[model samples]
Target: MNNYFNSNSVYIEEDFRCRFRMRRYVFERLLHDVQQVNPYFRQKLDRAGRPGFSPHQKVTVALRMMAYGSPADSMDETHGMSESTCLDTLQQFCDTIFQVHKDEYLRKPNQEDLNRLIRKAEDRGFPGMIGSLDCMHWDWKNCPNGWQGGFSGRSRKPTVVLEAVASYDTWIWHAFFGVLGSQNDITVLGRLPFFNNLMEGKAPQLHYYIKNRQYNMGYYLADDIYPKWATLVQAIPNPRNDTEKLFTLH
Candidate 1:
C-alpha cells in the first residue's frame, strides 16, 4: 500500500490508474464508501492481537482480482493474503460496492434521463435517437466443457455477449450480458429483457420531431445485422445520393 498510497509513494498517479483501472481519488472514494457500510473492510486485530489487513490492502487486492481477472491464489504472495481470505474479501467488496452505488450507477433511465438524452441527440441531428445499441464478445477463459460448444461461435472459442445502449456522452442507460456468443445480434435482441418495459407500457413516453413530423417513440441507432424495426434505425447499405450519404453521416 505504501508504494502507492503513502505520502512518499513510489509510483505516480498514472501508474495507479494503469494498474487499478481507476484514478486514485476514485479508488479512495470507493474504499471510503465500502468501509462505511462493511466493517469487514476496516482494519482489525486477530486473536493474537496482530493488526489484520488494512482497508487499502483489502480493497486493492479485491480490485486487482476484478480488474485483471486474477485468481485468488495469485494474491497470496503479492498481497500476503490467503486464497480463502482473498475470495471472501472480493465477495464482500462487490456486495458493498453495489449496495453503495447501485441507485445511481446501475439504474435504468428515467423520464428526466430520456429528456437529456433526446436533447443531446437532437443537437447532433438525431432528434428521436435515445442511444446507440451494440453487442460485443467477451472471451470466457474458464467456460465449462459441457457449455463450451454452445458458447463458441465464429471465433471458435468460448465467449459471452454483452449488449449495451449508450447515449452520445457514453452514458450507458441499459446493459444486458451473459448471452452465449453463438447468438447473433438479432438473436440477442430477441432475448433482451429491456424490451419488457416497453411491452408493459412502463417505459417513459418520448416526443420529438423530424421534418415537422412528430414521433412518440424513441429509437436506437443499430448496425445492419439488426432487423428493420421501427424502434431501430440503420444506415442505408448503399447511399447513391449526397442527401442519403449525408443522412448516413449522422
Candidate 2:
C-alpha cells in the first residue's frame, strides 16, 4: 500500500481539520481510541511482503467517506487504497465507533438532560417543548434486488426512512433508521423506541405556561401529517390571515 499521510506534508493541519469537521487533536484522540479497540487499523507488513496502509490514512479516508458520502472508488486516490478495501475499512470503522461510544452518545436523555432541554425550549417561546419530530428519506444506491419494491415508493429509487427527534442545537435525542420508504411517518413512529418509551412510562415530565395557561406534559413540534396528540404540536393548517400564517410558519 502507498502511504499519503506524511507528518511534514504540505497539507496544512487547519485544512485537514476543515475537511474532517474536527480539530487535529480531536481526530488523533478518536483514532487512538479506535486503534486501541481494533488491531486491523494498525499498519503491518503482510507475509507477501506488502505493507498495509497507515492508521492516519485509513482514518482520514473513513472520515471523508462519511463527510462527503462519496462512493468508495472515489477514495482510492485520496489515500492510495483499493476501492473494496476502502469500503471494508469504512464499515469496520463505523462498527468499532458504535461499539465503543453508543452507550454515552446515543443514549436517551436523562433527568438532567431533560431539565436543560426544558430551559432551552422555554427561551424559544415554546415552554415545554423538548425537540422536533421529523422523518427524512435517504437514497439507497445499493439496495438489494429483492427489496426494490418494498423500499421504493414515489422516489422511483430505493430509499430508507429515518425518523428522528432533535433539539434546537442540532443534538439528536432519538433516531430510528432502516425503515422502508413505503412506510409513512406514522408507521415509522409506531415502530420506533420513542413510542415504547412513552408507553412504558419512561418519559420525563415537563411544566410550562402558554398565555397564562399551564401545561405539564412535554411536547415535540411536528408537521401536519402527525396526529393531534397532547404530546405533539403540529403546525396550523389554513391560517385565517397572513399574520396567523406567518406565526404558524415561524
Candidate 3:
C-alpha cells in the first residue's frame, strides 16, 4: 500500500531548510511578547524531567509548523523529534502561547494610536477616514467533523474569517481572525472591540478637511454593509449621475 496516508514515511524535504530558518526568525520576534504574558512557559521550562525539547525550540518548531502548514511528520523529520513528540509539543506550545499573548496580541487600537492615524490621514487630505475595513476568508484544510457543519456555509468549505482595517496608504492598522465563515460582515464588525470604543467615546474624534478649513466630529467612512451609526458616514451607492460620480470620486 502507498505510504501517503501513513505517518511513518512522512518527512520534511531538504530544500525546506531555508524555509524552516525563516520561520524560526519570525517566531523569535514573537517570543519576547509571549514570554511576558505566559507564566506557564516559564514554569514548564523551569521544571525538571520535561521530556520534550527546550521551550524555545519547541515553540519555534511548533509555530513554524502551524504558520507554514507543515505536517507533523515534516516537523519531526526537520526538528529530529518523533512524530508523537512533535504533536505533543505543538499542542503544549499553542496552549501556553495563546494564553500568554491573548490580550496583548488581540487588543484593539487605543485612543493614542487612533489619534495619530487620524492626523496622518488628515495630512494626506483624506480626513474623516479612520481606517478602511475589509474581510477575507482563510481556507481550512482539516476542520474536525463536528466543526465542519458549523464552519461551512454557502461557500461549502471550511474557512475562517479575517477582518482588517487599513489606512489610505494601505498599511494595516488592526486585524482580527478566526471567525467562522458563516458570519456576515456586519456580524463580524459588531463583535470588534473597536466598535465598543466608538460607542463609548473611547475612540479618537473624527476630523474633516474642507477648503483648508478643519472641522471636528460628526463623520466616519464604512462600507454600506454597516448600519447607520451616529459617528459613521456611508458612501452613496451608484453615484447615479455624472455630478454624483464626481463627488464620489474623492
Candidate 4:
C-alpha cells in the first residue's frame, strides 16, 4: 500500500488539491443554503461542546482523504497532522458534512431543472434525453462480517454501487451512492428515486415534455443491459449482419 502511495503521490496530490478546492466551493455553497433553509448548522456551531478542530480543516482533510483514497496515516504525513488526529478529524468531518449537505445533495432535481436539461438535450442532437443513466462500481477493501452476504456474490468482494446520470456532453447531472456491491446494474436502477418518480405520476410533466419534443414516444439512451423501459432508449444490438453493421455505424 505504501508503494502504491509513494508511486502515485505526485498525481494524487495534484488531484486531491483540485478536488479539495472544488469541495471548499461546494461546502461554502452548502453552508449558505443551510443557513437560509435550515439554520441548524449555524445553531449547532454556536452551541457546541468544547470545540474540536476548525470545521474548514476537518472538511479539507475529509475531502482529501476521499479524493485521494489515502489511508489516514498517509494523510497525516501529507497534511502535517498526527495519524490519530487525521483519522478522528476525517470521521467527524464525514459525519458533520453529510449531516449538513445530504438533503441538498441527494434530493431529486425539481421539474423545472429536469425540463431545462431536456431542452438542453434537444438543442444538441439527442432530444428527449433527460439524462444518460449508468452504473459504476467501487472496490471495497473488505466485506464487513455480518454484512458480507449483502456485499458479496460472484465478485466475492465487498463493493459499493453508484448510479449516475450525465448530459450529452457527459457532465454528471446527479450521482447516487452506497448500494451494496453484490447488486447488479438492473437492481440498482430499479431502486433509484428518479425511476420511482417516473413510474408514479410525480414526473409526468417531464415525461410528457420528452414525448412532445422528441420521438412522439418517450425515449432515453442507455447501455444494452437495461430492460426496455418506456422512457429508455437502448443501444443498437451488436452488429452481426451487414445491415446491422450499417445501422450501428450510422
Candidate 2 error regions (>4 Å) = 1-29, 35-52, 71-74, 178-181, 196-203, 241-246
Task: Predict model 2's lDDT versus the native.
Answer: 0.80
Cα error, candidate 4, residue 7 (Å): 27
Candidate 1, 1-250: lDDT as tens digits: 6789989799999999999998999999998999899999999999999999999999999999999999999998899999999999999999999899788769878888888888988888888788899989888899999889888878888888888988887788678875654445667777888865544444356888788888788888998898767778889888999998998986
Per-residue C-alpha lDDT of model 3 across residues 1-250, encoded as one tens digit per residue: 0211124524343323454554334455556655665543443532566653554656666767776877888866667767777787678677776676666444555667667767776686557557776677777888888788767756888877777877666656577764543455677777776567666544455566678787666345677887777566667788888866765676
Strongest candidate by TM-score: 1
Candidate ranking under lDDT, highest first, comes to 1, 2, 3, 4
Q: For candidate 3, what is the TM-score?
A: 0.58
The clash tally of candidate 4 reads: 1
Model 4, span 39-127: residue lDDT tens: 22333332557544443454556667887787778866665667787787666555665676676455555667667777787776555
lDDT winner among the candidates? 1
